[model samples]
Target chain A: MHHRLDALLPLAGAILFVMLWWLLALSGVIDPVLMPAPQDAAVALWKGFADGTLTHDFWQTVWRTVLSFVIATAIGVPLGIALGSSSRVYAAVEFVIDFFRSTPASALFPMFLVIFGVGEKTKIAVAAFGAALVILFNVAYGVMNAKKTRQAAAHVMGAGRLRIMVDVTLWESLPQTFVGMRSGISLALVIVIVAEMFIGSTDGLGQRVINAQMVFDMPLMYAAIFAAGALGYGLNLLFLVIERRFVHWGGK
Target chain B: MTSHSPGSPHITIRGLTKAFAGVPLYDGFNLDFARGRITSIFGPNGCGKSTLINMIAGLMPMDGGQVLFDGKTLRETVIGYVFQNYRDALFPWKRAIDNIAYPLVRAGMDRAAIDARVDELVTSFDIGFDLKRYPYELSGGQQQLVSIMRALAPRPEVLFLDEPFSALDYEMTLSMRDKLQEVFHATGVTMILVSHDLEEAVYLADHVLMLTRRPTRIAEVIDFGAPRPRTSATLSEPGFVRAKAHALDVFQREVRRAP
Candidate 1:
């Protein structure tokens, strides 16, 4: 009972914040145009679905994030695993990796626009660049954290470098890689939306938000924000499902 | 194949030496393991017992000296290791059968031969209940049992066990020891076991090799003349008690005398 109550405490604060927002809007302390009422936000969500505007934007954001995630994983996982498995490679390249990781991925958005134009390609490139650092660091961590005993056992059992990776290193590093991908997905969503707002031609959830704000459509803008949150949450759920299936024997 | 007489040694170590960080663990260590017999190595903590076993198994580099099998080096023989801690030894992501088949697979054996060996082992070891279960699902003792079977499955000429039964309960340890003896007898494979427990050494080994503390060298070799099919009854034999007492005395004396 206490465990459950402790879990509910965070939700209680969220509920209180919503109640305050409703009261502020009703009392005119906050203008309805600036912050739509709860009922108004609901009506906007229903209308978005009824008219198919939300579906189009959501799918656009989904494809961009998916494409970025795939590209980042393809390039980052192997490179990270290779470097992290060797102390020499890690020492040589760690400084450069750290430099890129600390620098803001969005700071290069203008350069991306110049190189690829204001198209889906530009948005995806930005998202991939934004997500790659997380994937790389996580894969490195996963490889480095492989148990010494397992590695020794594999070598003594006559496993060469390739066989070691195939039989031992890959599966051992999977759980951590999945966890890193989970965090990377969150960053992917944010980057996808931000990229669209900054350098997009048409049709993305972020573009929808920017478009609504351009015309002073308060309810529509709020609807887009809620949809972004839902998309991020749904992606997180999908990652969890994948992790549970592949890493069923983890933690034991 | 080099043949030994009924009482000749199968494994020989001469002037074995190893050092870590400029500190010597073994300086001119020497011992011999008789053919077709279980030799228990007894020593106190940090006496390089595991290090010695590793050198014998070719798992670690040696600073000096030679380890011979059947009067020839490991170049002419096969060696297997049953690691001390099963929790960290077995591959957690692999099923029991897969783990047993790993070495054979790496050896480039035929698929049919590998499958047959895997089936034979899983059945003989009675790990069928967990043929598909990952290492994480098995208990520590069960994992150790599986590791032992896996090590033996490759049919190596000499098997080195480093505290293999230390993690098991008393009952499980006794039962597993019996099983191991059966396997050893059936295959006629030479066995070397490094252990800390005097009772265990007395129970399983035909000869117990005792070592001194760090910079360890062979202190003495105690021979247990107890017959095969060792049991709790063997523990009460006169030679068994004498061997255990002599081995313990050497260990306690050396551990105190060193530092």
Candidate 2:
């Protein structure tokens, strides 16, 4: 009973949040034009999905984000492991990785635009660059800090260095790699949305949100914002599930 | 059984030298370990007991040394090692059974043969817990038991255990001790154990190798001939008591002595 109650707490909080927003909408302290009723926003979301216009935008954002994340993981995981495995190499290149990781992804926009000429490839390339750095640093640290005892155990068991790296070091870095991938996708989604909003784009949740704002379609704008939010939350949830499945013994 | 005479030692360490931050921990150290005997290393704190074994096991580099296993370098020898931190030593990503098979996998054994060997170990060890579960899912004793299984999987000629039961509870420690003794009896592999507990040092040892303070030297090597299968009852036996008392005496003298 206690566990069941604990599980329901989050649902209760969500309902309460919506109810508070509902009450505020009805209270008229703020302009109704600015803060539409929660019901209106819900109906708008339901209608947009029903009419199939918002579906295109939602899927577009999903595709770009997924592609960027895929590219980032491909580049980051192997590169990170290589850098992390060698102390000399890691020391030589640590500063560069840290510098880019600290810089905002948005700040690289003009540079990316110049290199890729303000099109589809530019958005994804920038997002992948940002996410890759996040993942690379995480995977590198993960490999570097893998438990010494486990490696020693493998060594004493008569494993060669290459075998130890493949058999032990790679598996040991898995949890952290998942962590990187999870956060990488979220950052990718953020970058993809920002790019869609600013750069010339025909469709996407970001484009829909900005388009609705210009046309004074508050309901559509709010609905698109909620869709983007759901996408982010869903992506995080997906990666979390994957992480648990792969690294079941993580943090145990 | 292999012949274990002083004239023909199984392992010979020549001029083993190691320094920590320019302070010598072991300098020009030479020692011999008899084959097919359980040797327990007991020493003062920071006396480099684990360090010495690590160097011999080729897990750590020595400043200078030649460690020969019956006239071969460490690379030419097959050995097993169990660590005190069994949690860190275990691969959490693999199932317990797979972890045991890991060494064999590295040895390039075929899957069918590996399965046969792993199954043999599971039966011989009389393991009750499910080996399908990962190491983190099991209790501490079970994890250490897995480590021991993994170590023995390769059929190593020598086994090194560094305080393998120090992290376990008293009940688990007793059971693990019995298990280790059974393994020793069955294999007669040249076994070396490093321990801080004097009673454990005496109880499990054919010879207790006592060491001095830093820049450690052999204080003494006391032979313990009390018959096994040693149990809790043996802990109070006259021979066990005598060995323990002697080891403790040497330990005190060395711990207080100037390095």
Superposed model 1: Cα runs more than 4 Å off: A1-28, B5-7, B71-76, B126-128
Q: Which stretches of model 2 miss by more than 4 angstroms?
A: A1-5, B1-8
Model 1, A1-252: lDDT tens digits are: 999899899899978977887888899878778888877887898899789988889898999899999988887798879887998898898989889877787898889889998788888887787688888888888888887677767776777778887888887889889987888778888889998787845889999999999998989998999899999999999999999988987766
lDDT tens per residue, model 2, B1-259: 3355632589889999999999999899999998888899999999999999999999889999899898888888999999999999998888999999999998999999999999999998999999999899999999999999999999997899999999999999999999999998887788999998888989999889998898888899999988889999999989888888888888899877876
Best by DockQ: 2
Task: TM-score for candidate 1, please give it.
Answer: 0.91
What is the DockQ of the complex in model 2?
A: 0.81
lDDT of the candidates, in the order given? 0.83, 0.92
Locate the minimum summed-lDDT window of 10 residues in model 1 chain B: B122-131
**C-alpha RMSD for every candidate:** 2.9, 1.8
- Expressed as tens digits, the lDDT of each residue in A1-252 for candidate 2 is 999899899899899999999999999988888888889999999999999889989999999999999999999999999999999999999999999999999999999999999789999999999999999999999999888898898888777899889988998898889999998999999999999999888889989999988887888889999999999999999999988888888865
True contacts kept of 2: 0.82
